[model samples]
Target: MTRGTGRGGSSAAARSVDVARLAGVSQKTVSRVFNDEPYVSSDVRRRVLEAAGQLGYRRNNAARALASGRTRSIGVVTLGTALYGPASLLMGVERIVRDTGYALRVVNTMEGDAAGVAGAVGSLLDQGVDGIVISEPIDEAGDGVDAPLRVDVPVLVIGAPSPVTAPTVLTAGDGADLMARAATEHLLALGHATVHHLAGPQGWYAARDRLEGWRATLTAHGRDVPPVVTGDWSAASGYRAGRELAADPDVTAVFAANDDMAIGLIRALAEAGRRVPQDVSVVGFDDVPVAAYVTPPLTTVRQLFDAVAQEGLKRLVHTIENPDADPLPSSGPPVDLVIRASTAPPPSRTTPARGRRPASPSPADTPRPPLTNGGPAGDH
Candidate 1:
């Protein structure tokens, strides 16, 4: 084997020919093994991998790209936020893409950035990505329909409608509405006359879906659809909305868009002398880590971030590998609603809803109780 020395006299980097020679295979067989092309026997493939491992050999992705005209990398356009939902989805995508043997390139776009998905996609295209994943959480549709983005590669858009016109476009994780519907339905099934809604900001497509699901559930059940209380997906906003809802005697149940808001709403209700599952019942979306540990363990719907990423990437990779084949079908995200102590049937008797009553104290100040009436621990 020909070997060269570096400045410090270290041996040259191990190449495919070295791996092939050690494995007793031709250089072409080594290429097939590394490229994951099918015709070789399982035993030969394993031997090639072992030889490469022993020699510390790494495949030259750049050289392969030059020969095949494919970068074997996937690009992701995600919202530049630390919020749990978007961040979790992006992490899931990264994990799955790595496992699929494709390098991942991520570009984050802020909510108010002028160069939005279009600019992000342009950057990925410049880098020669085989496919792209749009994990944007913003409602980019605006007042009018946005002109479809130009992309030559296959694309997978999660949780929202695709804004790009591409050779192959796939979608997954659009089950937020169904999960919200489950939350609302749970409240209704508990014999609450009407369930109030604490919606997320209208600027997000996720928030819109949750709001719509709440409204639709109320309408279907012939219950009065009260005015929606909007929040910015923050605990502070939920507290503000809770203060308003506390003043109304009719709000015996509330369906919050997320767990953070729901926790804040619960605190506000406590301060107003409204006891959870006693004077009021609450259901929240996103079974966050703190959901089960809060004063009154929060009942919530879980978002299937990993599941969405797996299904979406599977379809996207299939499309990239077989250009003429139809995209793989997607099984929608599961609707997992965790039932905890925060939700219950309404109070048997009428009680004052407005000011703090001396008899009733805030749950936040009280000692934490054991969680009961809880469901399975779904994905965080």
Candidate 2:
């Protein structure tokens, strides 16, 4: 019957009223802090938490659920993969959710899992989460399945379109296209006549977005859009594409869908005696940790996983708290193009033809200022 006992029903545990008394605040304020309700000042919240910690007080989530009809927990549906992008995003979500005072329940769906997103949602619903976050969902049906997915809780889909027909479908962190555009544009700005693309598999929405952005950039700039070479978001796939590309002298610059592919492409190019930034330039997405320490250093678009997760979760929590209000408008993720030593102006074209030309000066040969076009830059 006592608060802060959760479902244990302990009579001796410290209650919210005790915390409020110790923190020199009203019991109402203590409830607001524990419930994660908005409008509580940071100082008051901190004081209440300190008092609760001192007294070893905890929230009676079961009682609170009965009173407010909310479990105060969130469910996350993500692809069960070790890929850098998805894994990093899930970690960010985990970190931010803890700060929101909501218990997290994650359900990962594998590549061939039956019902994929729908099944994941059903499982989470059964567990009774207040909200759901679908992070980086791949296109399961490939050709766009027409069936609508049903979900009752507030849904936040990140980095992909919402597959569900929930009452509150909030979408955020779908800026891969914009970042891809920036990467492609960066190579083009460096004087490559037309940049080649090493695209990821089309199944992933992120990959499709990157491919779309690359194609759109070339089209908008009036450059020749080369035929796309698809990779499997792996170094080996990139190496294969690179081997094919290396045979053609026309491949001056390549915008890979991800950093691993770009690194593999560079290795393949090196084996073929095609010097990077001298004979060819390369740009990639997701500036991974080792991007800077590679042989030539990779120029890449930095994906802000933490920032995206933080922003998206904030909006999700807001929707959970205020059911009637419209979902907040996203200001869009910040685009960061990290300039390293791997990109440079194309080699000189003596004959003005599409054949193999002499190697030009590398981008590192001259001291150039940090270059940025569409968005922010993190020059190395």
Q: Which candidate leads in TM-score?
A: 2
Which window of ten consecutive residues has the lowest lDDT sum in model 2? 369-378
Candidate 1: pairs in clash? none
Residue 237, model 2: lDDT of 97
- Residue 156 of model 1 has an lDDT of 93
- What would the per-residue lDDT of candidate 1 be over residues 21-44, giving only the tens digit for each residue? 889999999999877888999999
Candidate 2, residues 241-282, lDDT tens digits: the string is: 999999999899999999999999999999999888778899
In candidate 2, how many Å is residue 97 off?
Answer: 1.2
lDDT per prediction? 0.85, 0.86
RMSD of each: 5.9, 4.7
Clashes of each: 0, 0
